[model samples]
Target: MCRLIGAVSRHRAPVADLLGDDLDPFIRLACEHKDGWGLAFRQEDGTIGILRGIDRADDSDRLQHALKHQLTDMAVLHIRMASPNLAVTVNNTHPFGDARAAFAHNGEIRPVAALEKLIDPDLLATAAGTTDSERYYLAVRERMNRGVTPGDAITLTAQAITQSSDLVVSLNAMMLTPTGLYAYAQHDPHSEVIGRRGPAYFGLSYRQEEDLVVVASEGWPQPAGRWAALPDGEVAEFPALHP
Candidate 1:
């Protein structure tokens, strides 16, 4: 479980601007989602990179520094609320990828032993840390190695994991490619799971304004009914609004 934000705009924009407020008074979320944080995107020179730290986003100078331009093209900002037993370290950060793609998740698929069994062996080999999020990315990459698109790969990989595991599954996730930002929101919709404050905060939402399309985890500050919830169990792409 975590908080995530992804955005794509025709013109360059800073991450802070897209995330709304830095020290948002929403219970100081940036300070609370303190497991780790990361920013991943295709740089202006066409190389993708990640700037991250295993520190609270509110305290991470790196997060603020990179966020100044994380949304430069297509990018994602992830503030982790790591699952139980997962270490709080840099290797376990989100938006896992290389120069061509990046992937992040806001949900959990438990029993790493079982999850790893279903994942591709090669992916497991390359894994630098132990996290369902990273393994999910590897599984998707395995599907992509067969020639399907990244979005399609994610869908297939997610389906495989769901069928293989009996544990509760929440696949709210996002992937950044040169073409667009593809996100998936799937979980138990009617569960009594929610903050003591309101509805489930793990859902994904987005809003498009003129030339920019923004996606974020629920519970972030947004005007009433301004954000659109992503369809459950579906994969959708948010291309640059001006593209």
Candidate 2:
């Protein structure tokens, strides 16, 4: 139901620099995924900064400004298509998080109350939007509160969701933390999106160099030789050097 891209680099730089030409094409996907957009990155003072817009990324000057202005060592971008009933609002737009972490999810999880049952009541109360994606974030955060690593928490969260409802279209997401950018891909292969958008619609891919590593959702032009498809039901972590 969305598209996401993120990267970890050895040095702070604009997203345009980290993602290169792929950024434009990725932005273009906003034409179809035109519900809203968000970007999250580390600030110079060592806090996470998240900027979101209620307009499409391709047409928003805010997105263009952030693309060139928000420099950081780790960053994630999300363009939402929005699920059937979810409203398109700033609170519902992603790259959702607090001071330490930001998360963006690209899939739809049904009967959200099912996942909500898995999150602690106090933690679940922190959610601002009525979105399955926001609930997914809180569920992952609940696991992290118990000291689980981000990547493992993602895996566990997916398992819990499946065991409860098994209605996941895709759990694909990017979580940006101070240490790294975490990308997870988990989805039901039989989901209807495959027949409509091809087999790779829910697939994720990454390209890594010595100092830079990038992960992105498929559907655009990412060279096969440079970007390798991240396996379904797996998490990829790209660490960034601290200043």
Return the top candidate by TM-score.
Answer: 2
- What would the per-residue lDDT of candidate 2 be over residues 1-243, giving only the tens digit for each residue? 999998888888887898877898999998899999999998888888899998989999988998897788888999999999899999999989987889999888888889999999999998999999999999999998899999999999988988887588888999988777889988888888777778889989999888888899987878889989888888887766656
Give Cα-based local distance difference scores for all models: 0.76, 0.88
Clashes of 2: 0
Tens-digit lDDT track of model 1 for 185-232: 887554444433246576787887777787877765666477888888
Deviation of model 2 at 241, angstroms: 2.8
- Candidate 2 clashing pairs, residues 3+ apart or interchain: none
Candidate 2 residue runs with Cα over 4 Å from true position: none
Please give the clash total of every predicted structure, in order.
0, 0
Scored by lDDT, model 1 comes in at 0.76
| Candidate 1 residue-wise lDDT at 221 | 64
Candidate 1, residue 150: Cα displacement in angstroms equals 1.5
